[model samples]
Target: MPKTTETTLEINLSALTHNYSYLKSKLESNTNFLAVVKAFAYGSDSVAVAKHLEALGVDYFAVAYTSEGFVLREAGIKTPILVLHPQPTNFKTLIDHCLEPSIYSFKVLDEFISTASHCKQQDYPIHLKFNTGLNRLGFRASDCNNIVEKLKATAAVKAKSIFSHLAASEDLNEKEFTLHQISTFRAVAKNLESLIGYKPWLHMCNTSGVIHYPEAHFDMVRCGIGLYGFGNSANEDQNLNPVASLKSVISQIHKIKPNETVGYNRAFMAEGHQKTATIPIGHADGISRQYGNKQGFVFIKGLKAPIIGNVCMDMIMVDVTNIECSEGDEVIIFDGIHKASTLAESANTISYEILTAISQRVKRKFLK
Candidate 1:
């Protein structure tokens, strides 16, 4: 494909493969690696990421919802996909596409079983999600009795895996809490196993869990941010190579005198005479409004260019007085050299948010 007109997201398949291999090395041979490709593979092209992972022999793929799984299925991804959050309304479509749903609550379980049985489906694959301690979604430990009863009644729905989300696996200070969650999940999984007469695959660790708590890496590990190269901790962060780099070219330049105002609402007033460059990217392109008025910056010709004013829908101006760049010259938003983590720090967020928020409008180029 030709180079796009504005900004672009370059996905390095080689880095992805390396990260996968590295994470796999950290686990036991029999342990499965579930790549979380939801939100366009964390905002970097889910198809490309999933395809590369499938080729590399990833055991499974996971998404937050049923529609994301459909995208992978339609893209010719034959690997099994786990829908972390399944809605009752899309049970039919999910079953039709051979996608597995993660049933969290008793209500969810009852509804999914009812829907599947009504469709005359048998041994329909599904994952049971236990809340553990996140308190977001999933079955509470108190709901265990009801869950056991539900499982015995719903023979058509096969529980293929039991999983939970970790709330703070990266914070060493939260080690005790993390262990508590794991222990609780283990009990829940064991109880469900007893009722079902068999143990489904158990997974609880996300990227941080893979690094911080190896003992919790039971049957599988669902890696999201780690696979994309931003480990949640500093030690882990130092080890992974970021795979996605964002780049945009200068569309125009202007000289601003002292006291001059720039961008929407005149958010930035020049403190002194300065040169500014406009890049064809904005909130619509995933550069959030939080980066407006010198709060965030981008790298241009090896120098940092602070954002000048309100981030417009289609454009953002950066103070380029000190940077040696001209119109059409490329600037780095986030890359191996600049680092997505650094950009995220400037934006007062994490790399996960920045990476996942990158709009699909930006062209993606994959390089091995």
Candidate 2:
């Protein structure tokens, strides 16, 4: 990858391929793999990522909203797309785009069925999401019979898959709880199958679940963060490569005197003569305010430059008193060697939050 002339998020499809292959290596040959591309593929480029994954023979794609699935369809993605949290208002549009919805509640299910029927749809694919343990979404085990009955009575929508979200699959300490969620999902699926006389393909594992719980890799597994690189643990992270590299060039260099402060609120008072380099990336670019006042650092000339003072909307000044560098030199916020997980740790956050919080305004350059 060339040095970014501007604040840019360079996406490496080759890295993505490596991560995908690594995650897939853990699964059975027959197990389907679903790539979650929601939130702009975790603040990269969804279209580029999805197109690459589709070409790589991905089994399915998932997004948080129907509009995201529609975007994929518009991009000529032929693979099946599941709208993980679809709305009733968009049911007709979802059908128009041929996107599947994860019907989590009775209200959503009933509304989707009505919309599907109104649209004169027959056997439109839909997923049943059960609230096994992740109380965020999905139906309860007790609702299985009702769900099965609803499916039996509706020709408008067909159950393509039954799935649930794993709340703590990444934490080995919660292994018992995760196993219980899996078992509950299994019981619900079996009971639903018995009532419906057919089995919809089952899935409940997220990226962490895929890594820690092979036995719970029901019929499919959803790989989100793993697909973009961080594996939820240091040991697993070593096996994966980060796909996004946030880079910028030093916009300006400042020379400060003793007792002189930097940025708004005069946050950083120079103890002595110090050099500060301003990079054209800040909270607007997803480098949050939490990273200000020496909380975060950037790599310049292979050396660490601590961020000084408050983070501006479009700029941040970093202390470069020791590093010998010049204007136009490359600065690495995070890359394959220094992963986003590392930077995320500095701000007391997780890699997912850091990765997905990246603003869309930043230029995206892809390496295929």
Question: Top model by TM-score, which number?
Answer: 2
Expressed as tens digits, the lDDT of each residue in 1-368 for candidate 1 is 44435688999999998889888889999999999999999999999899999999999999988999999999999999999888889999999999999998777888899889998888898888888888899888777677777777866888789889999999989999999999999888888787768889999999889988999999999999999998887778778889999999999999999999998898889899999999988999889999887778998888999998899998999999987778988888988778888888887998988899898889888888
Off by over 4 Å in 1: 1-5
lDDT of 2: 0.93
Predicted candidate 2 versus true structure: per-residue lDDT over 1-368, tens digit per residue: 45679998989999999999999999999999999999999999899999999999999999999999989999999999999999899998999998999999999999999999999999998899999877899898999778888888989988889999999988999999998998998899999888888778999899899888899898999999999998999999999989999999999999999999999999999999999999999998999999999888899999999899999999999999999999999999999987899888998999998899889999999887
TM-score per model over all chains: 0.97, 0.99
| Pairs of residues clashing in candidate 1 | none
Question: Any residue pairs clashing in model 2, and if so which?
Answer: none
